[model samples]
Target chain A: MSTATFPEETRARLEVDAKEIIGRYPRQRSALLPLLHLVQSEEGFVSAKGIAFCADQLGLTTAEVTAVATFYTMYKRRPTGDFHVGVCTNTLCAVMGGDEIFAALKDHLGVGNDETTEDGRVSLEHIECNAACDFAPVVMVNWEFFDNQTPESAKRLVDDLRLGRDVAPTRGPDRLCTWKEASRVLAGFSDGRGAEGTQAGEPSLTGLRLARERGWTAPDPDRLPVGDDPEGGAA
Target chain B: MSTGTTLTPVLSDNWDRPESFTLEGYRATGGYGALRTALGMEPDALVDLVKASGLRGRGGAGFPTGMKWGFLPKDNPNPRYLVVNADESEPGTCKDIPLLLANPHALVEGVAIASYAIRSSQAFIYVRGEVLHVIRRVRHAVEEAYAAGLLGKDVLGSGFDLDVVVHAGAGAYICGEETALLDSLEGYRGQPRLKPPFPAVAGLYASPTVVNNVESIASVPSIVANGAEWFTAMGTEKSAGFGFFSLSGHVTRPGQYEAPLGITLRELLDMAGGIRAGHRLKFWTPGGSSTPIFTDEHLDTPLDFESVGAAGSMLGTRALQIFDETTCVVRAAGRWIQFYAHESCGKCTPCREGNFWMVQVLDRIEHGEGTEADLDKLLDICDNLLGRSFCALGDGAASPVMSSIKYFRQEYIDHVERGGCPFDHAKSTVWGGTA
Candidate 1:
């Protein structure tokens, strides 16, 4: 029944950004998700104030805004860590040592799933498939990839983060920022740093490289292969 | 081991080129040529070309792509829309993410052509939130396309104004469903809506819409560039044209193997260097984990939709997750069930409750705590979940449970008989301790 409010300066800044996001959609209510991201960009978690702010911008009740916020797993209800470390434990990744990485990190970092460390540095959790199965046993830091990771390497990666050492994603932009900065970028505000990272990995290009090497292609009408369908003239 | 199937690189042809994600790189490779040709033709004619090409949806369900576009009513005064489902969350399915990351312009160009064919000015690409790098690449591609006059008002001086919005979803698997995606786009919880007025009738602000998969849309430019006969020349009769079969797990070389529809896993395994080093293939999915598991006996089975279905599995997403002999089938199936349980969305009781119950039983069985009745109980729960649930998510949850038990019921019994998993836990575990 109670709702918190943001500070005046933060509220004014979000209002300007909210208007731009709302303008992107024909209906104001549709801006709810991005607006939640915008608020999370300002505050690490989706606070009560953040929910109230989204409701105000989208002209919806707090309950409706809260429903959408709680539905998605990405929006943090509590304060998240400076570095959100997620190990993929989906079927492929788990079989490829993701389960091991997850269990190791839990003991190594002294935090369970979705729990941030006491130092407020790293929050570790088991994420679903990130669609990067080519780089199996993937570990993501602040939503950037640390691909083909081993448990030892992942342990060191988190330690480096907590110690304030510079860490880099295996396949991401040259620069690595905190989780908050990534959230801001997701809020539709361009940071002028786009497409400046590694594009594709070796695993992604394996099939393409093999195809070019063998000179193989879709069956050409002029020069079909020897085992062409007997009934086929052309498809 | 070779089945002699040639690798056909349709969508991934230019992926190796540097800056393939850039507009210049795309244009250099004859990227937007199809858009230029398609813009000059009647939109209906372009639709007919796709229909004649026998292009089917590549986002798990093998529905006809052109027929999906034709479902949009023409008389509606309200603006129609095109939503590209880039939320590639199906386990072991990795093609769309890499495709967008390596060559986003292909999809941007596809979006333009698709929107033009559907007579819509606005479109959206809904990408999953976890892959920030992919989202950034897609956003940059859209910006570059707009700056090049390939998007926005009067594209390429063809008088077809279009706008593309790249939206990011915040970690929910159910949003990959087309209806749930539309609902997520409309700023609601990503839950499937009731049918009767499907997405074609009312979607994304109550306007007629066509939701196509990322691969399905990206395949369009090539189809338009080449003739329908050219597109149809590669794949089978019903399932025509090439698709990306993502081969992952214990393979010596795992990646997206682009081939024609009817290519068998045996040939693909040969291309991928065959199941790690010396280990033999134990079980695999023709698609993602949502489909039933296939053993080495079915290695020669053609992977087209019809053939895969005939062999008792839907070609859902063409994600071939290969597991080797060292893997425990019961443990693997348990992990997949945990995924379904974690992502059930809790909208329908069958999916939500059935997944939770299945996870409990599967975990107990894997940990040497289950009795024989648990096996029957697992199947009974699967029976309740399949077909009785709201969406395919329920059926998908039941697939690995039922199929794994069908093939590897002995392994489940062994876990109980031996009082533990026979396979070394360290081989699969990171810390090498017991579960």
Candidate 2:
């Protein structure tokens, strides 16, 4: 019987990660999270095969890997859209009418929680808290945090996202720090505010004067580099 | 009654003048001096001191801040990480955002000190994707820390290196859970991670990580500046420390009330000038919406973990979302259930589907269409979903529904029995404006 073998490159990436589990842990399961990251990064998603791969790499049973993956929020067992939209439906944001925001996105994009858009452009997941209580009623599109979001804003956002419109410029995203100045605006409102997604004119997005001053990145959406013509320089 | 403390400062306690956020201002306020002092101490000793302090997580879960730091494996090649959960999205949990806005440096310094203790050269303060302004402020603080040599390589020449990166979530509530947060930080969709190997064991970048709430980390400076005994002296034993109780929703002075942890809600209400004029207490959340709901009956319950827990609720995130008699219990529960429903990251069935179903039932009841069976259905679903989810969100989402129904079933019954809300009809439309 003939058996398939992993390519050398794939084999190298698949090498044992005992380093993550070594030394005085309760068990081999301690390395589950790291193993999951490795498997997910290599496979782009955690399939049964990926779980097996993690199990093999970590010297653990497949059941253990599956259990760890099943345990955490970060591990995605299924395929998701390129741009994931996590709508906050917790205390602060929910009171502010995040319901309308979630509904508008669902209606506008034709996707509910965990279901990707028909075109696979976005996946909408209703999430508990994104931690920006000050900016209740917020949605995370891709990696950038858009605050004080309204249904109308969500509509514009979802629409622009579908069309692949330009992303608004943001500040300090490069540095990886929380924008403290936005709290001033967040403080302007109170809790139990906004019942459904956001007020008709709310989810006030732009923050602090400095944020506006610094330009932001829209995260270029070019799927393949081959299509664009370098009219000005490439030739 | 008032320290007359003044609302001038938002968060920059030790750095901004009133602790201003400016670089020069931070320098003047004895900012990096603590980092300098900390650098001279053996890293493990700092960890030990923190553990001795018995400081619990302040963001919400109240994990022992010091004990959490001690959990990092001392001998490991893996890069340990420190993540500050600045996604203060809890209802009535407004302290962190405001504190970060007013005092980003406090968190930054705390991060730096914490990084040094855990020997983690890399740290990330995971902010909520929203609150762009606070994100910017934290970035500025990080920039300041880097410039002052408090962050970046060999911080203060302690031979310890740390990089404080501020990664914002794509704005999902579940990301606040340390594991879900680690997932979000790794650039995945945000959802909660089941515990057992809490972030202390494996976290950011899948390395040994210390995930702390913003308040938990921010309190470090004070803890370090003073002593554990000083901190413990204030709050009751087993719940030792100070905390920021956010007073909102019809409070006379709706803001953060920083006091010893054991202080009762009655005292906090007094500090906040009591509920808004002519408004008496109805029901409220002791922490964010997750912990069980409390009412005027619980006003005197000591706002400590043990006391609150003993009273059948958690002192989670101390976000007092107070309501008054004017508010409708059914309507309020419906609104809160709507939040849990919408935010239920659906990885598990109970939260994702359960919250949605609960909201539907509550909506019918709120709209005077619900039957008594709906309430039973709500309870039944909650029983199945609570503690059955992949993360605590399921439990949190069911908290208000279960607690509200327990305390105010008649209010729900009244809605269904009367065929209309007995409370203000004016407010019913307010909640329904979403459609």
Candidate 3:
């Protein structure tokens, strides 16, 4: 492993961002994760320069910073493609078609897990549980969910990404951006795309909808004993 | 019992409303009414109210919420902290992410109420990093709360000042554990710390901290708004109040079912339109993949902390991952074991080594290379890893394997005998397959 330094211009920009991130925490060491993300946003992955930058900003040794950076799965150690396509291959999703989707994508792209395509358009990996089980067989591009996915749909999604065609998530912003832009947002810098939309799926709101239909409410102090039944009426 | 059950949706009540994530919409829907009510009362009294309400922690461990809150030191010179474990990484647990995404203000409001009750000024919501959309929604909600004087200094005209930071965790399932989450928040490898100086005493910068789950904190506003007795009246004696029961996998309506803790799977299955179209329920997890798998016979087992435990599994996160007859039990268990193997932090020997060996055996079993001796080896390894590991992650790793072997040993035997899975792969298509 060789040590490298960030460019002066890059270092200057990161210093400002690093200061802002460190300001959020009581102890400056706590900002190490976000700072690594910040540097990763600039570079494709956690370069030798990124680790050095994080260490310099947090007043920690490179070894200390490297340990934290390597421990987390998000921070890439090497250059990745523009679109990081992660298909959920956990239990529910795999059983639903995540396995097939992953297999198909690997064949379609002619690249294995964590491998970038020849065009550098997409990098594919099998992610564990994006926490959208209801929308099983979810394929996430740049961390935006492409829910209820199949092998064909997922392949089409990556194809569109590679062709520079417009792509939208199942329930996200109007359009999808490159993986770098998503990383910047995850680094605590908003891309002004925050206000696009923030609606959950219909499945997510099922309980609330069912409750409303039945006129079921949490027991109110003032309206106690208003209903004949102690338990709210069955929906 | 009625075929259809009415659920008192506490955390998810405002999920369907438009702009529910916004402060204005939340206020319109009587959100933060609890924070206001809680602000008027003494913090200790609020704690007592939660204690009397019997609100247990919704983060899988059914520990009493108020008791956990009360564990914090009363007169610590260092600032006491309130850390919300929004790291909803349990495989089948899907409620918290949706809760934060749809109605983030509910969690924001809950954070406010909890911070005040615990007398903590600084709080952090350690959300999983993969869900960028959820993180954005929560950040936007926090910004809204701050602008409306709901957060920051002297909240809601009350003298209580609090600041909430929404921190995103780089993908690690162990971070879902409270201690590991604290370490992650402190910018270290997300590994579980030994107890004794639990988060309540020395956590996050060596101060007294109260780490509550996303759902647990989100449920606080409702508990405070509607008195303790009101909240207590819902669930069973041991487990009180409504909780988000995440129904996923083969269920017809795989969604968050916010019902009382004592509700049975039979009733939930009915509500979910029963295992897809016509498939019969096979083995299922009452909680996430971590809890012991249950079968059709246990459908009537109440999903409370006590009943589920009595039925031989913890009421873990209420992540009911339903599997139908078409699914392969061995294959599913193997997948779960692989997750545990992948997520093992490599801190403790049992978890680190045991899960690795289990996955190898499980893979062999699933791929038709396993023998009867592999079954004995699997059980032996699970026994070593069960309660002997450093944290619950080790124990969780062994659960699906142990439970599957317990209930569906024949399935394992059949795999060995047949040299392959018995279930047809075509029947378990991701979509366009008959139930």
Candidate 4:
């Protein structure tokens, strides 16, 4: 199969990026991972040509680039899609059922780890930690977040993205994060709940007092209520 | 005064207030005025101001920020890049993400100012991959700056162009290490490359680079708008400047506490509401969990780099992970070891294998399955990893491992002798079971 392609401009840019990556490493062979990332950004995989090009650009053998590319799971040595759904399966997320989300993606996308969709829309990569642990089972799609995801929400998101609908806001009915966890995360950083599994640390009066002292707080989010479920937290 | 009683000299003012995150609030409190001042001054003078302010890196190593900037070979004919390490994955470090969310402009302005000073056209904010919300907030702030003409070409008609790119990591703690962060920013597997090339001479794209912490860069605009002397007047002699301490674990306030350097934990706790009301402080990190642990006896020790170093530990990121009396030192150490094990990049043998082994020993001790010999063995393992590994992380991971044993050796022994954790039943209720 042909190596999955990216926007052509990305390919031209990867060359400069490739030289810089090679230039950073003392050993040319070490440039392989960076080269793979460059190609992935452009071609969506470290295709044979991509590997050969990187090897030639860095003055290393093709086998050299292939070695590091295959060694790390993040690099795809085959054709894949542009939009990658990264399911975080690290310990905390796993304990909170990140596995189910991974499974659901595999089932919904009809591809296992790293395999792309038939229409070349999305690929799945099982990752570790989406970082918002309190609202666990987070899947990062391209650069956007899909947190507290269940199979149903996962299906809806994939379907929406597949249909070319903007999944930007990432809220409303499909927003699976519980009211408490979602609000805490959206509310920037608060210690969430004292005894709950939420570990976002405590809030303070330094900023609270300064805002009040300077009269900078109230009119800012003028109409937004302080205790509202999910509004001012949106930046 | 930017000291106590609700004063914010620059970015962090009003962060405790409900709507302080809005652009309107940040604008009302003299936010972008620094950017205007920075735009007025020559980039060289801003660098001069920072150099005079004596600001140091807040990402553990505490390298002088101005000195680090000066390290870039100005006449070397290579494009310099400023990469902000927003990857706050250190075991007890929670300050940066909160800071970014609260005042993204602090970093955005810093990035803009640093990029101009360094003559870099592009800047990248490499955040912890896990902080999706924060990444979003920062990105939004960058967009806001660009819209306001604070970023991009000819900022406020200064005829200089800079682009700020907010990139997220795959959540590796190792990436916080300067060289590793560069590797990740360059879009690789996020491993630490060899140093001495040290991101100044040969960094991101084999050019001059500055890899600074979120707090370090965020502290810049103030030093720029306010004179260097104004910046210097707050803290002690060497470590002059305000700092953000991520006070977590058993602390009463348990959040990001921003204050000048040289403040004592007693003073900090007095500000933080004091040890969860009833509990007395037992163990804590003067910086993050990576630094050596400090006891209550050291409460009055100044938190500046010179003083902390005089007291035997570098004044690292100043992420104070406070543990009160009810918390078991062994369990806390065990939990920290688990984080190190999970975060160890596994590139070097000593950190990769050593952290895993320490976790196993610590796990056994935590679950009532350890022997007395294991305590010594734990110390032995940490000693090997301290300077043996490739990066500072191994050295950092070894710090807590060694200190927990140093100050609380008897605690480890007590856990082993009892065949279980001493505070399991007593303290589990405090955090409501997870401890």
User: Any runs in candidate 2 off by more than 4 Å, and if so which?
Assistant: A1-235, B1-19, B425-435
lDDT of each: 0.88, 0.65, 0.86, 0.66
Candidate 3 lDDT over A36-108, as tens digits, reads 8898899879988889888888889999988998898999998989999999888888887888899999999
Which candidate gets the maximum lDDT versus the true structure?
Answer: 1
* DockQ score of each predicted structure, in the order shown: 0.63, 0.06, 0.58, 0.08
Comparing 2 and 3 on DockQ, the stronger one: 3
Alpha-carbon runs more than 4 Å astray in model 4: A1-235, B1-9, B16-25, B429-435
TM-score of each: 0.97, 0.67, 0.97, 0.71
Ranking by DockQ: 1, 3, 4, 2
Report the CAPRI category for model 4. Answer: incorrect
True-vs-predicted CA distance for residue B112, candidate 3, Å:
1.3
Residue range B1-435, candidate 3, lDDT tens digits: 323456877777777777877778888889888888989999999889888888999999988889999999877899999999998999898888888887888889888988898899999999899988888888989998899899999998898999989898889999999899999999999999998788899999999999999888888888787777677677876787889888888877788888987898998887777887867888888889999999998988888988889889989989888888888988898888888889999999999999988988999988899998999999999999989876899999889998999999999999999998888855666574574
lDDT tens string, model 2, B80-163? Answer: 878788877665576776566556777898888888888777777777755555665677677777887777888777777887
Across residues B1-435, which tens digit of lDDT does each residue of candidate 1 receive?
A: 225778898788888887888999999989899999999999999899898889999999999999999999988888899999999999989999989988899899899999999999999999988888788899999999999999999999999999898888888999999889989999999998877588899998889999999999999998898777777777788888999989888888989889989999999988989877656889999989899999998998999998899999989999998888778998889989999998988888988998899889988989899988999999999988999765788899999999999999999999989887898755653233222
lDDT of 4 by residue, B1-435 (tens): 112322223445646444455556567767777888887888788788788888888887888898888888867787778889987766556567657766777788788888888778878787764554565567677777889888988988989898776664544677888888777665455688987777899998788998898888988877776666666555656777677765655555555556678778887687667876656788778877678889987888888887888776767877676666666777667666776777777789998999999989888987789998898898899879989987888888787778878898888888878878777333422233233
B176: Cα error in model 2, Å: 0.6
